[model samples]
Target: MSVQGTPDELVEILRETVVSLVRRDGPDLSARQLGVFLTVYLGEGPHTVRGLAEALNIGKPAITRALDRLEEFKLARRKINPADRRSVHVQRTTRGAALLREISVTMAEAANPQRTAGTPTGSQQGLKP
Candidate 1:
């Protein structure tokens, strides 16, 4: 698929996004954890351990470990499926949904071309003209 925007612009967007997130004192999510969290929050569900594992190309144990951390942080939870005793479903917590909203807002602000001087730019605190 074709990607839009120059490498530098993309770099700037990501840089600012991270800075904005950090400024908010957000939780530190590992790459893998972020992937699973985003997938679960953004995708349609009744998500399961097995389904998340396969979708993320990760093993079930890894998903379990991530889920464990998510649970520890009160970001996500697992419930025993009522219809299938052998199955577990992952559900998003109120905090998790709130975090997703925070991330979405941060990303939008960082990417806004009209963002002011104080906004982070890859190497500096100002966006290039």
Candidate 2:
């Protein structure tokens, strides 16, 4: 049976999958925390505390709290920007990269429920164009 959905619907499914993965792997992280990490990780930055707050449209205090959570998990690191000792930059640690990788894999698998059906084996796995 072929499954069909609009782009938004598929995106919602993907979001749910990612949430589930996050809950399973790091229950301590809220969805907001994940969103903040992704935005910083993908943004053009120095990824400073202020930059993150501005990018996320949130208060600096809130960003700081989120950063604390990430640091507690050892998934991200914050270091003083050598260019300016007063500034700090946040970066994903090795553990963060590994977590992201595993979450992505889980999302891929969850996105396609058809896989459980045992048919059309291998790479072309019904990935619609």
Candidate 3:
């Protein structure tokens, strides 16, 4: 489904979602690491470090660093490409999928906080006067 909102509203949604992520107990991914993780999980793959760097318009070393962080969290993994042993393929893990689901829920709630149980009303949140 398509979600439409004013620019301010969109930014508020992003802010709220990020705040929720920050307050959560799991790994706190940097912007680059999160971008790389999303790209791998959301995009169709055969994803290699080279391909990610190209897709993201980032350097290979930066991509490698992001992948390293992801691997440390067990959110993604690299496997040697059998046909080309020199290449490494990025793969998603169950933990990564679960994290994505959590993010989706957070975004949804942020987008409609009034509908969420125990969420303060606009006036209470100081969004309305």
Structural similarity to truth (TM-score) of each candidate: 0.84, 0.73, 0.87
User: Model 2 misses residue 99 by how many Å?
Assistant: 1.1
Better of 1 and 3 by lDDT: 3
- List, residue by residue over 13-110, the lDDT tens digit for candidate 2: 66657556756746457777887777766677669899898888899999888888888888788999998999999987888878777777776675
**Candidate 3 lDDT tens digits, 9-76:** 78777777777888999999998999999999989898999999999999999999999999999999
Q: Pick the candidate with the highest TM-score.
A: 3
Candidate 2 TM-score over all chains jointly: 0.73
Pairing residues by index, what is the TM-score of model 1?
0.84
Regions of candidate 2 where Cα sits further than 4 Å from its true position = 1-8, 15-19, 22-27, 116-129
Estimate the lDDT of model 3.
0.90
- In order, candidate lDDTs are 0.84, 0.74, 0.90
C-alpha lDDT of residue 69 in model 1: 87
Write out the backbone clash pairs for model 3: none
Give the total clashing residue pairs for model 1. Answer: 0
